[model samples]
Target chain A: MWKTVVRRLIIMIPQIILLSMLVFTVAHFMPGDPFTGIIDPNVDAARLEELRRAAGYYDPLHVQYFRWVGNALQGDFGRSFAQKVPVTTLIGARAMNSIRLGIVSTVFTYAIALPFGMLSGRYNNSWFDRFVMIYNYVSYAIPTFVLALLFIYIFGYQLQWFPTRGSASPVIPKGTAPYYWDMFYRLLLPGFTAGILGTATTTQTLRNEVIDAKTQDYVRTARSKGVPENVIYNKHIFRNAFLPIASSIGFIFSGLLNGSVFIERIFAFNGMGDLFITSITSRDYSVVITLVLFYGVISIIGSLVSDIVLSLVDPRIRIE
Target chain B: MATDNTLIEVNNLNVGFRFGDEYYNAVEDVSISLAKNEILAIVGESGCGKSTLATAIIGLHDPHNTRIEGEILYNGLDLTKLNEKLYNRLRGNDISMIFQDPLGSLNPVMTIYKQIEESLIYHTKLNDKERYDRVLELLNQVGIPKPERVMKQYPHELSGGMRQRVVIAIALANKPPVIIADEPTTALDVTIQAQILDLMKDIQEETESGIILITHDLGVVAETADRVAVMYAGQIVEEAPVDVLFTDPKHPYTRSLLNSIPNELHEDGEELHVIQGTVPSLQNLPRKGDRFRDRIPWIPDEAFDEDPILHEIAPGHKVRGNSWKYFHFEGEEME
Candidate 1:
């Protein structure tokens, strides 16, 4: 299994390189340069050309790529053109917030999905099952941003149950119990909104998996062995049912990260998603490329993580 | 038919499955019994409800979707009337089952030791060491080599034959009096099938457990069974001691089934006897009269009783309906 993990990591080297090239090329070809917002409008066209040349902006694409790659190898993503700080520094401060939000949302997703799916599957075609089915359909149909906004309106503004925007109260001092409590309280709405949006697929997948596992020949064997219904479900059914769901954990992680962009925008949360939008609009090429590359690497690692998880749970899946 | 040595008796057992709002009987009013130290083979083609009867005996059917009627009497208790909790105590302790597909029957993720130990855990008070020893013993009893090595491995690591043996070991864990093997060797190759059948016989001899061996293979029945019950549709159409059933198959369905088997006695150019038509689905089965009539159209309608029931033609020999008495091939005249 360690061998498999090492082999996968080795193979990811070329993949990451290719992904970096793609991200850089896409960012470079976009309409405006990073200097557009930074330089004065009254500056002469020759002066602007000198600035561009001085920055090596006139260099060939391959040269720029290699230069970027060389710097990237040394943990130097260059400075964000707009922020005037290292691209890594700009991202590091916000990445944690995004990760926290993603983690909270993931927790909510599984909390709502697992029991609901298991029960719905256990007592299939019952009223509770029907209710879950309806919930799945409605949740699947609604757009993530719309759901987030609706949640903010209902749970935040209208009911005054939770804070509508930002990750924490500005008044709360850092490193205090109250501050952590306030942070958790403020994280609820956006996390739940994003989390609820994700539940439909996980719930549906797990529901179908549970139903399929119940009918398997092993379940019958379990039953024939005089195992109690509860034990049969706990030992025989749930583990097998969770196999497919466990295998998709990496995809779920990547999805949550992608979803954070819209979720963070609506919540006005200071996360990677908020930074991403701001950087893109301001044409901070270095920051944008770094963030894109970070997301790309994360998604690649996510799949590998899920593979390891699946192999751990399912004895049949020998990674070697 | 409830003799002193009878292990289980099914009195007019009717197993039904629901389709939409309607309930259709899959096994209709079938009566049979298993005696101690005997192998009772229930032979039928697919869709004949042989499997349904087996599951019904073990009380394995989903209660919500299934409607099982009649009595499954075991040790003065009505198995049909037992709730899930009661059934749990009775199953694996008094009665156990071996399923058809060995690959699918054993839990893929569970180690062989855990699976074998499952029944022992539920039925016995054996501690960790005792359970561990019993697991290895069961594996060895089923003729599995390297019991110590195989115990730690999952179902996927074992071959098909090995897996079936593991399944048998699981069934034999508690030494249950009645073992319902539902086409136990059906999923195995011919050579493996023979080995599994032999293992079952050896286990039966040593344990003295009553075995209900359900299969479509007449060869398996002839080799291992003490008595044979021939099922057509959902009912037992013919039943007798194994030799009697094979040498003088009384039911038309039984005769047709026997004749269909390819043998060396057949001439080079002669065509094989094929039973016409397939077994009727539960929803389409004839609720009255001999259910096998449609497949043997050449047999005169007059020969079939309006409401056919098992009638004893000789001591320990029973056939359903009078049609078998008048049954003859289409090109042949009545003797």
Candidate 2:
């Protein structure tokens, strides 16, 4: 098992490099020029040419790609022409804000979905089961942007229950206890709205998986041994049912990131989503390539982690 | 033949499942008993309710839509009325079950030791260390060698014979007085089947625990059962001492079953005799008279009793009502 994980990691380095190369090629030829937007309009054509040359825009595409790749290998993601800061520093700070939302929403999804799924499945076709099914449909049908807006209106604007815009309070002093609480308070509405969508889909799907697991022979054997219903649900059934949930965690990170684009836009949460959009629209090649490559690495690591965790939970996977 | 010191007595057990507005009886009006140190094999083709009776003996029925009637008397207590709490106390300790598919009978994720020690944890008052030692001893008793290595192995790691041995080890873990084995050897090879049967017989002798062995294999019944009950369409059509069943089989169904087996007299690739038609499904199950009537048309209308009952023909020999009219063995009529 450890060998598989180690080998997977070893293989991932080349994969990540190939992925970075692909993103670099696409972003390089994406129409708008970063130097055209940043350089002064009054500058002479010769000086403008010099700036483009310095940025390696006039070099062959492969040459430019390899130059960027070479700098990236040494941990330099290049300086943003627009922001005038290293791409890593900008993305690093914002990634923390995204991480907070990602972690909390993930916890909420599993903590809420797992038990409710088990109950709905155990009592499949009951009134409560139908209610959960309907709830899943309704929550999933409402688009994430719409839900985010609704939550902002009801919980943020209409009710004054939470802050509507941005991630932290301007009034609270930084590094203070109140600032941390204020940050959490601001995230609650958007976080829950985003999290509940995942919870809804997962809970319903997990209910189905659990229903299937209940019919497995091991469950029948467990019952014959006189293991209590609750023990059977928790010990025998949930372990297998939760396999889908474990693998889903990987892609869900990327899903949540994609979802946050509009959510942060609507909520005014100045995180990676906002930065990504501003950089892309302005054709800020450095930040765009950096964020794009960063997301790719996250997805690869997420899948790897999911595989390893699944192997740990189910012994059958350990040897294979 | 004489059921003295009965360990588990099932009286007129009826198992039915409800679908929509209709209820279908899977096993109806069947009664049997297991005595101390005896092996009672209930033999029939697939879906004969042979397994249903075995599960019902341990107070296990379908999780939903199935109803059980009549009394399962163990220690003079009707197991039918026993609450799950009380049932739990007796189950895995007083009465245990081993199932048909050996692999499915044990949890795939659980180690052999954990599966074996499950009964010990539930039934015995032994500490973990003692349970561990007892598990190895029980493994050795079930004919598993190098039990230390086997204990840590999962069900998939072992062969079918080894898995069944693990299951038998679990059944014997608490030293239950009655063990219900539902087609325990059906999933194994012939040699392993014989070995498992012998091991069960040895266990029965040493512990004096009654075993209710449910199977469709007449060969298994002949080799293992002391008393045999031949079931047809949810009813016990004939039941007698093992010797009498093979020698003086009285029911038309029993006669046809014995003839279906390929024998040495037949040349290779000869078509075997098969009792015509399949067992009746739940919806078409006959509630009165002979359920096997359609399959044995040659027996004549007079052969089926107007009111069907498992009728005793002689000391320790029983057959379904009116089956005595046309009873024959190996094409020879009884005097």
Q: Model 2 off-target regions past 4 Å?
A: A32-34, B1-4, B264-271, B328-335
Best by DockQ: 1
Clashing pairs in 1: none
Model 1 iRMS (Å) reads 0.6
Please give, for residues B1-335, the per-residue lDDT of candidate 2 as tens digits: 22568887788889887888776777888888889888999999999888877777787775477789888899789998888878878888888888888888778777888888877877778999999999999999999989999999888889999999998998888889999898899899999999999999999999999999999899999998999999988889899999999988878889789878977866899877777789888788778888888886666687678787887889878888876676554344555
Residue pairs clashing in model 2 are none
Q: What is the lDDT of residue B121 in candidate 2?
A: 78
List model 1 lDDT by residue over A1-320, tens digit each.
67766777788888888898898888787666647756778999998888889888889989988988898999998778887888888888688888888888888999999998999999889999999999999998999888887888898889999888887778988989999999888778888888888999889988898899999999999998989999988889999989988998888887898789989999999899999999888878778878888899889988888887888889887664
TM-score of chain B of each: 0.98, 0.94
Per-residue lDDT value at A127 in model 1: 99
Q: Give candidate 2's TM-score.
A: 0.95
TM-score of each: 0.94, 0.95
